[model samples]
Target: MLYPTLRPIRGATLLLTAGLLAACALPRVGPNKSEIFAGSVLREGDAFVLTVDDRVNAIAAVAPALGFSAGFLNAGELGADTIRAGDTLGLTIFENVDDGLLVPTGANATAIEEVQVDAQGFIFVPYAGRVRAEGNSPEALRRVITERLAEQTPDPQVAINRLAGDGATVSVQGAVTAQGVYPIERPTRSLIPMLAAAGGVAVEPDIARVTIQRGDQRAEVFYDDLFASAANDIALRDGDAIVVKSDSRTFTALGATGAQDRITFESRTISAIEALAQVGGLSSTAADPTGVFVFRNEPEEIAEQLVGQDVTGPQRVVYVLDLTRPNGMFMARDFAIRDGDTVYVTEAPFVQFNKTIAALTGSLSAANGVQDATGL
Candidate 1:
């Protein structure tokens, strides 16, 4: 009978040990066992003429007007000018009178507003007939109208009137509240108002990623400085597009890390170590100090391209960094991560097993308690 009792006791001890061992074998699920390098190894600045298909399509969905204009002009032209066709023209005219003598029938008229300019660049005046208005200054247009009307009446009372027709329009696209054409009347229009018309910039407009496309060229501008400084708020020309784009760059931290994750870099640079710190550091118990590994896309290929060389080898390569040493801290700073970098942390074998064992034991204990309460 004593031997039988001893056997049951030993059996219980073995089961407990097995459970703990199984738990130890479980995988680590947090950041302590994993690491993420915080920057893109991919370089975005390189000038590549390759056709951007689906990406361009997605961008167009957010700002359809951009796609329309981009089709008309190359990426480069879109960067500089803001003017586009179908915008209203405003004109001011001063009719010539005998020196300073006012005509008996003369009446002062304000400059015309909303003068419609056809696609052919002709402005229709009520009495003056169709006048070529494209590429002419307001004063020049005033003179042209004055001369034409002079033929009809002596010192024809002509005051260049306000623009009544659409002169040119610029489309505000992407991340704006209302994405549509904005009519330009003056040489200068504030970006805020234009954005307001299209619905102000989309929530959290990638402040650093504003793009202006004119003709074939594309210009990347920072919205913060551009809007803050009056000097930089460049006057918009016809056919210009103000695009508030989405943030393409992002860093994800997942696992047993303290904070778990963070987005956006306050500074231009973020390192693997810095990324870890941003998320509340690593968990000590389940963390495997020696097993820390950072998986990242290979940076050498991009770096090679930046220096101007063709890679004849396979393009598949992933970088692994060991963070066990003090020197590894410097790698985070030296190795620049690009947008879309993912950081992962793994758990230590012992800690993982312990967690699993604890979970199992807790589950069993709860089941036993329930059965006892039910008298089963």
Candidate 2:
């Protein structure tokens, strides 16, 4: 009876060992080659080494808008300039005191208060009646008010001034210190200030997934770009809703790695080397110099686009990087990591024996249990 049991156990052990070896030899499916390469290396003209010069050039390349060529030159780059419906504008009119000879002091006489601008850009002024202030400059609105007042008083002096009015309001929801509606003064309002106003982002805000919605257009703003490249920090407009989501998913690096479980960087631009360092670097015992694998999701459409081309799939293209090679280190820097990239460092072949032994011990335990039950 012992001989028969030993033969069967030996066969089972051999089969398990073969299965484990086959599993170990299987290749990992990584990110799409196109997407990885596109992000890994900077464009020919673009700067790979992020520096002040790169920032300056990036700013210069931005298109001019609203009489401003770039963010560096824009002084009135605030939200107040872009007026929208429901925004309150303050208007102040003063009577010509001292026969218009002297500058009228605040004490002379006047009325000042906040007034709401209607959707049609109409602001109801006291005594002066409704005035269309939208699309008009501050001076233009003042002149319009003075002209309207001429109908009521002869030689009636009018002073048109923009009083503080309601500014455009936007809602910021998700992974922020505070999530609520923020009032923006104009369309050119910088997003940084708004995020600051909302109490900044949470400790682990989903930086890669920041979404900005305005009307029908939606833009994804990654944290790394927002912080690293000033050009990517977009201006906010009225009625814009910014949502900062929290990252619930995490990447697991197992098998003789420095850290078994590590949270992925919220920024989409992190490199493969940076990711490895984040988990306390590679394990000396199990890290194979040529067996580093980065597993990531690949969309079918993006994969198909790379099939015929020189590029690999945009979603899943396993990059076999040799740490021993100096060129490979540079390539690691070029490989831009995506949102859910999993960096796995396979153990040396000897590690497989440890796993196999553990499995055999469990099998023997089960066998003993069966023998005891049968009173063998």
Candidate 3:
């Protein structure tokens, strides 16, 4: 514990010297540049000069391309979910009372039967055989069945109810509480509701990355976007496969920052400015206001455009944002921190020089019996 009584008394000259000494304290050490931004992305003219704009644009465009934009809920409401083959149907044939071929005595004038739609999209009945059942609703199937039986029996009534319809189903797997196939019975049902039906995420998936794979292509969105934007809460179509997995996006904060740690994002997206805030911002004493760099691996397309070559894969790009400028603030705000990014703040160039002077001053003050003004 520090107390006034045990503190060092410093003369004006010594006080100034000690103040300068503290200002020149060593800046925080961070990850090596070669290790963080590894690869040919930084090789001479072959290297593409990447910037924050490139990253933001790539992500902004890619996210929406993967179905992360707005107006999805409205569009989903338009599609009607209909029956398909492999769905089980509860079929009942009814006729006027009195004993008959279709309605036997004490059979209650209703013949209840369970039938499954075949691969050829057909269902068999006692009299109406080989009826097409796929692509038609249960009610529609009942009408079709009724028309087929009308000629066989007078006043033949038919009722069809879905027993086990697994046709309109979405495959929900990976890190979800209930991983299985969930049937989509209503057109109004969207992504969130479908997740709820599958028993919500198993252990809170990374909200920024929930993937949806349809056919050969895949799309992803931030978890919050499903609820925050209607377009992101896209309606599920038949055979839409969803995956809620752990967060893969993370950035490391090093060098002259308030805290040096690998920070993982909880939200779908975070800007470079927001990322700095998460690590408690830059150190006022050690950090150079003009030296803020974001280290990242850019997409190949971006690399090829700037490099003017056929860059096949991810390229290393170091984006430097000068906080000393007024525009830098806006730039940082617009600059997005991507997955596996590293935010580094370099030390001021004069810090080492200042430290050498302060060390000499503090020594002279101590030899002359001048106590430290800061009481250290």
Task: Put down candidate 1 lDDT per residue, 1-376, tens digits, no spaces.
Answer: 5455443443364476566766564445643422222222244322222111233222211211111233322222112222223546665544455332223335443356677656786777655789886756556677788787666555654444333433456788877767888766542354545666676666564333567776776666555545555544454556778888765556777665675664665444466677777777667765554444444333444524433456543233233444566755555434544455665566667775677668777766765575567554
lDDT of 2 at 37: 41
**Backbone clashes in each candidate structure, one number apiece?**
76, 23, 7
Across 1-376, the per-residue lDDT of candidate 3 in tens digits comes to 6576544433445666666666765433643334334433455433333444545445423422345434333444423446788888877777775665478777746656668888888988878878887777677778888887887777788877777866667899987778988777673367888888877777555453588876765677656557665567777766778998877768999888899999888666688789999999988887876778876666887656545678688776667677768677887887777777888987666665675666766566564553344335
Comparison by TM-score, 1 against 2, better one: 1
- TM-score order of candidates, top first: 3, 1, 2
Best-to-worst ranking by lDDT? 3, 2, 1
Reference-based lDDT, residue 21, model 2: 54
TM-score of each: 0.54, 0.52, 0.64
Off by over 4 Å in 3: 1-65, 68-88, 95-101, 105-112, 118-121, 162-167, 171-182, 195-208, 215-217, 224-233, 245-247, 266-268, 304-314, 350-376
- State which candidate, 1 or 3, has the greater lDDT: 3
Q: Is candidate 1 or candidate 3 better by TM-score?
A: 3
User: Is candidate 2 or 3 superior in TM-score?
Assistant: 3
Q: Clashing pairs in model 3?
A: 9-371, 10-371, 70-231, 71-231, 72-231, 207-223, 208-268
